[model samples]
Target chain A: MTAETAVPPTAAYAADAVLTEVVGLLVEVVGDEILIATEIDRDSSFNEDLAVESIEFVALAEKLEARYGARVDFMAFLSEMEMDEILTMTVGTLVDYIAAQPAGEPGGEV
Target chain B: MADVQANGLRFHVQHLRGGRASTDRPTVVLLHGLVLDNLSSLYYTLAPPIARAGFDVLLYDQRGHGMSDGAPTGYDVDTAVDDLAAVLKACGVTGPVHLLGNSYGGLIALHAAYLHPESVASLILVEGQCLDPAHSGLRPAAGGYPGGWVEDVANTLNLIAIGLECNPLGGDLGSRGARKAARMRAGADTLLNQTTLIEDISTVRLLTPGELAQVKCPTLALYGGASDLVDSGPMLAGQLPDCTLEIFPGAAHALLRDAPKELLASVLRWLETHSPAAPQFTGSAGGYRLPASGGEGAP
Candidate 1:
C-alpha cells in the first residue's frame, strides 16, 4: 500500500535530503532534548556514532518505512548485512539505498 | 515494519526473500520469545545470517508486542498456532516452511506442527521448553507460576520501571530509552499478570510421547549446557522420530544473545544437512507436490 504524503510519487528524493530526514528521525528517536546541537552526516554510523540500540533501530526502521513507503526495503537491506556491517552502517549507505531504488514504489515485493 | 492483517489483528511482519530460487525451497520463519521481546531478537541475531545463506526469512512480533496491535488477550498456545497459520496465509506462502523458535516460540512451533502437520517442513528449537512439563518435570505448583520465573518476571518489570527513571542510557538515548522502557513495563504488567497468558501456558495441553513420536518431520533441538532447561532438549530429541540435539557448553538460556556465532554455526550446519532448498518431496498423495530427482537430500 502506498503511504499517502504531500510529495508527489513522481518526485525523487535526493540522497542528501534523505540523509537529513534520516537524521531527523534519529533525533526524534534519540530524543529532541539530547540531540539538540548534534550534527549528523553521511558518514555517521547508527550504532557507533549515534549509539542506536537494537530497539531504537527498530523504531528507526518504522520511521523510514513511514517516510519512504514501499520505495525502500529497509528490512531487505538489513537482512543482507552482517552483524559488524549493521554496527558500522552509515547514513550514506541508507541514503544510497533509498536513492538507488526505482523512482516509484517498485520495491514493494521481496 | 510491514503491517499485515492476520487473525483479525494487525501484525508487524518482516519478510526477507533471499536469492534462493525455486518454490520447493522452504522459507525460514523465526519466532521470538515472550513479553519485552520482538522480531528484532532474531532479526539482529539469526535472520540476516540465514538470509545470506540463500534462504528466505520471515520474522514477526507476536500480538501485543512490538509495533503490532496489542489486544488485551489471546496469548494462549492455541491462538499462537492460529496466528502462525494466519501469518503464513497472509504472506501468501503456500509451500511448507521451516520454523526456528526461541524460548516460548519453540512451543508454538511444536504445537503448530502437532496440530497442522502439512504446513511445517521441520523445526529447530533454541533453548526450547517441552510442551509437556510433566515429561520434563518442569511443571509449577498448582495455581502458581514457576518458582523462580515469578521472581524473575517481577524483577524484570521492576527493573524496566526503575531504569526508565534513572536515565541509565544517559545522553541522548535516555529519553527514547525511558519511553521504550515505560511502554515495555506497561506491556509486561498486562501480559504477565492481567492476561490469561500465564494460566493458558500453565494449562497448555501436553502431547504424549506417543504423539510426539508420530510427528515425522526433521527436528533439531539446541540448549545451553548451563541453562536450567538443558534437560528438556534431550527429552524432546528422544521423543521425536528424527531429531538431533546440540548443547552449547558454558552457555545459558540466553544462548542466542550469549554465543550468537556458535548458534549461527550450529544453525547453518543444521540447515545444510536439512537443506530445505534441496527438494525433499518424493511421491506425494497431495496436490502441488513436486518430486525430488532422488532421495539425496530428502529427509
Candidate 2:
C-alpha cells in the first residue's frame, strides 16, 4: 500500500466526493468512451444503464478497495444482497454505502 | 486488478486476503468454466465467504477469456494447466493450494492435480467432465450429438462461432448499445472466429481412469442432479482414490449459479474436514463414498 495521502478522512466521507471517486473508478473500468455515450449520475444503474458486466463490477470493487480501503467492505455489502438486488443496484446505492462507512485513512489495512 | 504475465500471455488476476491474516489455511484458487464464464462467478458468490472463513482466495481470467489478453492458439488442456502453473508462480503462491473449478475449469483442475500433485492440496470439481470419450465409450447414440464431451463442446462452439461471425456483435458501439453484452459478444466472437479455441477443445486430451487414479489428493466432486454431465460424477468417485461425491437436487449444469448456497456450504465443510490444521479422524473409510442416504434430490 502506498503511504501517499489519499482523499482526507473528512472529504472521503462526503457523499458527493464519494460519488465522484466512484465515477472515476467506473471510467477506469468501463473506459471514457462510455462517459461520452452516457451521462453517469447517482441514478445511473450499473447493470442496465452503464452496461457494466459482472467482471467489470469486480474490477470496480477492487478500485473501491484501493480508494477507500478496508473500511468499506464492498464485497461484504454485495454478499448480503440477493442477485436481483445487486443487478438493480444504482451508483447512488454504492456512493451511499461508501459515504456511510466510518471515516478512516484510505488504503489502511483492516 | 493485477495483470499477470504467464505462459506468454497476460492474465487478469485478483487476490482476496483471508479474514485471519496470519491463518495457516491454504489459499483457494478458483477457475471458471469455458466461454461465457469468468472469475466473477466465483468471486461474487464464493470468494468473499471463503476469505471470511480464513482462506485466502485467488481468481483469474484464463487465456482468451474475460479481461485477459486473447491468444490465437494454445487453448488445449495441457496449455491450460501450464497457464495455471505459470499464473501461480507469477502470483508468488508457492504452497499447495486448493483448486475449485467449474465445468471445463474442473477438468483442468483434475489434470493439474494429476500432473502436479505437489502443488495442489485438494480439488473441488463442479460438473467436471473427466472421462475420455475413447476410454469411457461415451459414444453418442445413433443420431445423437456426434462423438463425446469434446465433440459436443466443439459442435456448440462451432455454432457460436458461425453466429458470431455472421452477426459481428459490438460493431456499432456508439449507438443503441448494451456495451457490456456487446463487449462480451465481441470477445467471444474473436476467440471463436479468429482463434483455434474450438479445435483445441475438440483435440483436448481428457483424463483416463488410470490418470485419475494417480491423483491421490482428497477430491470433492459436485454435480447437479439434472445436469447432463452428472454421469461423470459416479465415474470420478469410482476411479479417484479418495473422492466424495455430492449432487444438488433439481439443479442443472450450472451448480455455482443455481445452488450457490449449497455449493458454498459443501465447499466450507470439505475444506474444514480436509484442512491440515483439522483434527485427524482415525479409521475413516475414504475411497469413493457417497452420503449415507439421499444421494439424489431427496427431502
Candidate number of the best TM-score: 2
**Residue B175 lDDT, candidate 1, scale 0-100:** 52
TM-score versus the correct structure, for each prediction: 0.72, 0.87
Q: Is the docking of candidate 2 incorrect, acceptable, medium or high quality?
A: acceptable
Cα displacement (angstroms), candidate 1, residue B182, comes to 2.6
Report the error of model 1 at residue A8, Å.
24
lDDT of 1 at A61: 80
What 10-residue stretch in candidate 1 chain B is worst by lDDT? B290-299
Summarize candidate 2's per-residue lDDT along A1-110 as a digit string, tens digits: 75547645554447887888899999998789778877889998888888888888888888888888748787789888766678779999999888888768854422
Top candidate (lDDT):
2
**lDDT, residue B168, model 2:** 80
The DockQ-derived docking category for candidate 1 is incorrect
Per-residue lDDT over B155-237 for candidate 1, one digit per residue giving the tens place of the 0 to 100 score: 66455545544543334434544544455556666676556655565556657787887878889899998887776676678
B72-160 in candidate 2: lDDT tens per residue?
A: 99889889999998888788777778999999999899889988887788999989888764574544335432456777899999999
